[model samples]
Target: MATAVFPYLPADELKKAEDESNARELSWFLDNLQEKLAEFKHGLEDCYARLSPLEDPESSTLVISTPKSELVKGHVTRVGTRVVKGSLHLRLKTLPSLHLKLSETSPLILPQLSHLRTLLNNALDCVDITRWTGDRHSAAFITSQLHLLHSLLLEAQNVLTGPSFPVPRPGTPHPLPIASRTSGEDGNEHNPPWYQCIPDPNTFAPPVPENLSLHLIPTTSSLILTIRVLEPTAVPPSAFNKFALAIGAQRRLEHDEMDGVFMWKGEEVKVKEKVRVESGGDPVLLVLGVKLQSLEKGIEGAMMSLRAVMGLSQEKDDD
Candidate 1:
């Protein structure tokens, strides 16, 4: 068979490949819920830099936790892990009576807790991760959903106090900026011949937490990489500079060392990154790592959006 051109794979096949990969990855997370839970628990402790005993309050049992907000916050602890023998320092603001009762004496609710735990574990096991795809957009979607859920769970915990805080006053309803050309979904970075419009030099990323990572490994022909991140509300200024530098360096290397004339901003970065901002705050930064390489023989053309070729299918499937 002739050499296949990089980034020139057919659309249908690319989507299938990405779908399978996403399914497998998600399945892995589900299969080893305990391990993931452990990883998350350790991660939470590390990020929060606090040793508060897993915040178990009375009248309510802590079932599980996930990344709580845009900024990395909490995680779910799986049962069977060594529970520190000492008393946890969880203070219950909602019901001090219940809190004291539970802590002073382990409540009979252990059974209830165990039952809910079993139910949750089973639900995760049978979760229809089919709702997810291997595409960057799908990944972002899942990350966003998880983020929102985390926030809601925390809010619910606080609200159980029965209006301790002032009633929230109604405010102007601001519509989300999806309509603006300025704010686009991270997924649309690969719109074909128009892919130029997608953010190049842009990382294919979900919202990223501080602990999550984005890495790029350059190959003779293409880049290989892994990105584990949570979604961000907006891009930081330093992140923007890093993106500019990486794209510039890559372009210089291609031109100076490899005798290539590829378009860096045009092909390497998404057009959205170049979006002209007319107001508000600086745009939210989403980071993705790109691995680059030259196309091989056989294919007459090569097309790269703001993401890997395998990413094409992911984008489509997400839509």
Candidate 2:
């Protein structure tokens, strides 16, 4: 017989969990923000000609500073493609007041927008992998993105927030705890908030891209996935050179326990990230792949095996 587990947690205990989760999330965002700023600064220095259009002396930079509110906090916005040639513009807005728009050519904008989209998607993906089982962290992260994307969609055209895109919703309660909250000295309740792009259930499914393929399998504890990347014609040859997929597991070591191994008849396991970089300066793309496997054994053991495979593939790419 299977042992029974409680679904609803005690109110006090749930509150405590939320507090701890928020701290960790805030830390992750701060670290990523620093890295993003550095990359933007360096790109500006290296390609001034590519971003010249946005540097017009007549245009004034707009600032929309306001008190940090639940709906407007942690929002990031950027402008990639413009209306001209040989110029690129980038605008990053994390809050209502913080916004920048650079006027540049289409080529410059495309690459920058692509990179930014990758980063945003990667961040959300990390949150998805870590908070797969519903909790406050998952809600906070997803909520922030929804609000951010909604605001962007209102003013611009973003494929991710398009009608075809579907945002994952919380499911039945499990062992994982939901996000927590903290109280200020003045006794005000503070917790990360959730935002919806368009509250209607009808508009939730993500628009499918012609080249993107998704595979999902349900297991005893969690879901196993294999994502195959098909090269898009719009992406240049150089953009196809190096491809890396980063997997973030919620319970890093518990991966195996949740999804049992198919080959060994054991528990599921988290695979180590495998990065493949190609040789030669020419523009050739590879069929990139990401697979989450079951490892009856420990996490370290599985990663070692994956590293070996990646190394061998890299050698072949070089040859």
Candidate 3:
């Protein structure tokens, strides 16, 4: 019996079994493909709905502000990646009290916008695939495409709520903020936008005075306004008085509110805003301790001669 036994199988029967197995595999793959296709279809529909509107131009009021100050304000009308009509308002005290009003009608494009949008659209283009053979490779392709679409979709959503900033107006001597800006009228090579007394803002902190540390982060999100006020125990000494940089002294008095004004650049800057006068005729403290202009219009204007400053690089937008 052992000698008669053979280890071989019938060729036709083996082939038939293989065919059935292949059929089952193919069927399973088709089911997986269908699920993937349905998911992709729904996702694509949603992505297009959001992205399509961005193609059409939109205009917005862009404000670059900090937790306690407004650094820049502008009216920007954008058509896709570049500003079609816009203006930048900058008030640097080193200048001769001139608020830089850089107006732009020419397009000022950012390189970032172009690259990001190109990547996003390429994902959209992937929808028109040559073919998927309903195999493992096709599944992988579908997975990769869907992953890309999902990633960009999330990134795009974060961009809609803007933390705005002032970009340089096109046609200026320097279209970028960090670039050395020559006076357009004078065309002098030696004259930079900032004054001689101040170190280049691109490299060093501006000439802000001591006592109050003026740190302008200049990144997308940071600015320091650490006011060095005297502690309450130290307030009575001759070195410091009730009014001079007293810590927590400027807390708004809980009394009848009054309006006041201080002069800046020949403009009557509004002050004493939301601050109530104390019962003893003591000057009500402001949100600002020693830094008086810590007032809204003041620090916001960054019109501070000794005040702090901050800014964000203007971001490129695809619409």
What value does the lDDT take at residue 63 in candidate 3? 37
* Best first by lDDT, ranked: 3, 2, 1
lDDT of each: 0.26, 0.26, 0.31
Compared with the true structure, what per-residue lDDT tens digits does model 2 show for residues 1-319?
A: 8773368678898888777776676556544433433443343232222223354431212222223322111111122222222111111121122212222221112232243234344434433433343343343443343344333322222221211212222342122111221111011111111110011221112222222222221111211222222332334434223232123222112221111111111222112111111112111001000011111122223223333433335354335
Q: Give the CA lDDT, 0 to 100, for residue 215 in model 2.
A: 26
Question: How many clashes show up in model 1?
Answer: 28
User: Candidate 1 local accuracy as lDDT?
Assistant: 0.26
Tell how far residue 4 is off in model 3, in angstroms.
Answer: 34
Better of 1 and 3 by TM-score: 3
Residues 1-319 of candidate 1: C-alpha lDDT, one tens digit per residue: 8886587769898888878987776545444433433443343333222112243321111221112322111111211211121111112111121110112222111121232233333323322231333232353444443343334323322221111112222342122222232111221221111122222122222222232322211111121122222223343436765787778742211111121111222232211111010111111100000000010110112112112323445466346
The top-ranked prediction according to TM-score is 3
**lDDT (Cα, tens digit) per residue for candidate 3, span 133-202:** 4233443454454445445544433232112332333333222222232212111222112111122222
What 10-residue stretch in candidate 2 is worst by lDDT?
Answer: 282-291
- For every model shown, the clashing-pair count is 28, 29, 1
RMSD (CA, Å), candidate 3 to true, equals 21.5
Report residue 146 deviation for candidate 1 (angstroms).
Answer: 7.3
